[model samples]
Target: MAQRAERTERTERADAQRNREAVLAAADALFAASSSPHGVSMDDIAAAAGVGKGTLFRRFGDRSGLIAAVITSRLEPLRRTVREVQEATGSAPRQQVADLLDTALTFKIDNRNLMSAAEDAGISSPYQAQHYGWWHETLRTALDRVPGVHAPEFTAHALLAAIRADLVAHLLDERKMSPEELRSSLAAHLDNVLGAA
Candidate 1:
């Protein structure tokens, strides 16, 4: 009887893990497909995942927690790329800074809906995010390496603000600017900020 109970516990753990993955996957798909991620709700996710709403709350604590988990999962690859850029050999500081901002801009443009949802859920400031510090420090470090760049930290913050999710969304969605046009403008802006190379 004890052995049977142990087997049942193991099965339950496995099932819980599967449910968590299903929930994340469903949330990701729903958010990506939605024009407005704020329209997605915990109940929608639970239903899509074939799990109870209570189970979602039990696993993720709350809606914001679940959204954070989904964003973290989606950002893992981008984080890896950022790390690689940081560790790459022989790239000039200006070039590295440009690369970093460009990478972040592309990510913001791609995931603006998820980011907008995060903001609508009351996570209004990127500084409140765990990953924000890493991004800031990475860009600040690159800026520091550049000889003529003044105020590395502030410049880093300013550059990040330029590519912020809401700003990107506003430019693309509201202002009707093309992504290519946005990219070109960012490149030109970076040239002005970095100043010759």
Candidate 2:
């Protein structure tokens, strides 16, 4: 009897994992195909994923929660890369700072829709989450190693704010800045921030 119950629990967990992946994939496709985040609805995601709407709610809580999950799923690879860079030895602090911000900026640019969905769902406050703190602390650590940067804590925050999701969307969607141009401009800005280091 106990073995049967254990098997049943394993099956349920497998089902849950499958459902979560299906939902994430559906959300990603829908967001990518839509011009705006507002166009995609929970019903749309549920239908595409072939899961009950209740399942999404149960697993992710609500619209913002679901969108956060989707965004987090997309961010995993970038996070892994950043972790490796953090763990790596002998990299210059200035280059580390640029690499971290550039990697983050590229993710925002590439996955603008995911971030847009977070904004549309009213989950756009970056500072409210541990994710934001992680970025800030990592950047501050690198900035601390640099010779000339003052107030590394505030410098980290300022640099992160510059590449924020809404700003990325505005620059790309409204002001018509190309990714290359934005990257170049950020590099120049970094040169100023790093101050000849």
Candidate 3:
């Protein structure tokens, strides 16, 4: 009897893990495909995942928690890319800074819906995010290595501010700026901040 119970527990754990993955995948896909991620409801995610509403609440706490989880899972690869850029040997510090910011900006542009959903769910400030500190530290370290950078910390904050999710959305959606134009403007602004090498 005890052995059977142990097997059942193991099976239940495996099932729960599968459910979690299914929920994350469903939410990620739905948000990515939607024009307005905020329109996505927990019911929609639960239905798409083939899980019960109670399961979602039990696993992710609430809508915000679920969105946060989905975003975190999506960001894992980008975080790895940032680490690779930080460790690359041939790139100069200024170039590294540009690369990091560009990488993040690209992510924001691609995932603007997910980001907007996060903000609508009350996580509006990047500073409050768990990953924000990592980004700030990475950029600050790179900025510190640059020749003419006077304030690495503040400069890091300023550069990150330039690529913030809402700002990117406003530029692309409201202002109708092309992605190419935005990238060029960011490069030019970075040049101004970093000055001539």
Candidate 4:
């Protein structure tokens, strides 16, 4: 009976993992297709995932928690890449700063709508988010390695602000800047910020 119980526990864990993945995937698709994240309710996500609303709240706590989980799931791979680059020996700090901010800008452009939804869900300050803290620390560490930066902390914040979700949305949605154009502009802007070349 003990062995049977252990097997049952393993199966339960596997099912829970599957459910988690389904929820994240369903939420991702819905948020991506949504013009506004506010309209995509927990019930909608639960229906899409073939789960129940209770499960979503039990797993993710609330709307903000669920949104953060979805964003975190999407960012997992990007986080790995950022870590590898940040820890690499002999990586030029200025170029590292450029690469990091450019990647962030691209992500913000791609997920602007979902980000807006997050703000609507009461994640009002990006500065208050955990991921924002990680990016700020990581960028500041790289800035610390550069020659001329006097205040790595402030410089890191400034660089990150340049790629904020709202600004990216306005540039693309309002000003009609293509992703390529925005990227090119950011690159040049980074060059000035970090110095020539």
Candidate 5:
């Protein structure tokens, strides 16, 4: 009887894990195919996930909530990377700053939909504050290594704003710059701005 109960528990856990994966995968595909975050419906997500409507709502609460869940999950790796960089690196501030910029840009490229979805969800005020706080702490820690630098907080904000999806998309779509060129320009611009401060 105990063995049977253990097997049942394992099966339930596996099913839950599969459901979570399906939801996120469906969300990614739906978001990518849409021009805007609002363009995708809950039904679209459900169909893509091979899930019932009840499952999605039961797991994610609402569309905005689903977006938040997806974004948070996708960002987990990025947050880990930044945290590792902060802990493991003994390099100069200039290199560390560049590393942070590169990582942020890479993340933006890979998770464009999550960024768009987050914006569309109207995550303002305290949400924005928490976001900035995380970036500022990352920036301040690295910026301390740069010679004769000040205002790490403001610099962090500038770096973040400059590397945002809208700006990068504008550069790619409107300006027609290649990814390599955009990255080069971004790194140069960041260094220039930090140098001035």
Candidate 6:
């Protein structure tokens, strides 16, 4: 009897895990498809996931809460990449800075719309600020390794502002800078400003 109960518990756990993955995957697809994740209704998400509407709220609480979870799920990869870059020691500060810049650009390109939607959902949302804090801390860690850098936190904030999606999009779409040139110029600008190399 105990063995049977244990097997049942395992099955329940597996089902719950599968349900969570489906919800997150459906949310990701829906969020990407919609103009904003906030634009997607809970019912729409449930229909997309093939789950009942009640299940979604039971699982995620509300639209903003679900969006936050989805964004957090997506950010794991970027966080992992930052960790990998940091673990790779022996690069000069300039090289580290260059790698960080590339990472920042890639992250912005990947997550910009999703984050914007998150912002449109609510002002008190913790998603944007938390993400900025993560990136800023990652940059600060990399900057701290430099031999003679001053004000690593300030430098991190500066780099973030300079390479953020809004600024990059404006520079590319409005000012007509190609991505490669923007990257190169910004890298050089940081190198000059931060005295990295």
lDDT of 1 by residue, 21-75 (tens): 9999999999878888677899999999999999999999899888888888888
Candidate 2's residue-wise lDDT over 1-197, tens digit each? 99999999999999999999999999999988877767899999999999999999999999999988887788787778888867875788888989888987897788777776776667756676556777788889988998888799999999988888778888988999999999888888888777765
TM-score, model 5 to reference: 0.81
- Relative to the unseen true structure, what is the C-alpha lDDT of residue 158 in candidate 2, on a scale of 0 to 100? 91
Q: Is candidate 1 or candidate 5 better by lDDT?
A: 1
> TM-score, each model?
0.91, 0.91, 0.93, 0.89, 0.81, 0.76
lDDT of each candidate versus the true structure: 0.86, 0.85, 0.87, 0.86, 0.76, 0.74
lDDT of predicted model 6:
0.74
- What overall lDDT, based on C-alpha atoms, would model 4 receive against the true structure? 0.86
Compared with the true structure, what per-residue lDDT tens digits does model 3 show for residues 1-197?
A: 99999999999999999999999999999988887867799999999999999999999999989998998898898888777756766898888988888887888889888887887788646688766777898889989999988899999999998987778888998999998899889999999888866
Query: Evaluated with lDDT, which candidate comes out highest?
Result: 3
> Between the candidate structures 2 and 5, which one is better when assessed by lDDT?
2
Q: Is candidate 3 or candidate 6 better by lDDT?
A: 3
Better of 5 and 6 by lDDT: 5
lDDT at 32 for candidate 4?
84
Write candidate 6's Cα lDDT for 118-185 as tens digits: 66667363425667678788788878877777888888888877775556656765798777888788
Whose TM-score is higher: candidate 3's or candidate 4's? 3
Best by TM-score: 3
Tens-digit lDDT track of model 5 for 45-102 = 8998988989999988888778777777777777887888778878777888888888
Give the poorly placed runs of model 5, Cα more than 4 Å off: 1-13, 32-38, 125-133
What pairs collide in candidate 6?
none
Clashes of each: 0, 0, 0, 0, 0, 0
Residue range 1-197, candidate 4, lDDT tens digits: 99999999999999999999999999999988876656789999999999999999999999889999998888889999888877775668788888888888888888887776776677657788877888898889888988998999998899888887767878888899999999999999888887786
TM-score of candidate 6 versus the correct structure, residues matched by position: 0.76
Query: Pairs clashing in candidate 1?
Result: none
Among all windows of 10 consecutive residues in model 1, the one with the lowest summed lDDT is 123-132
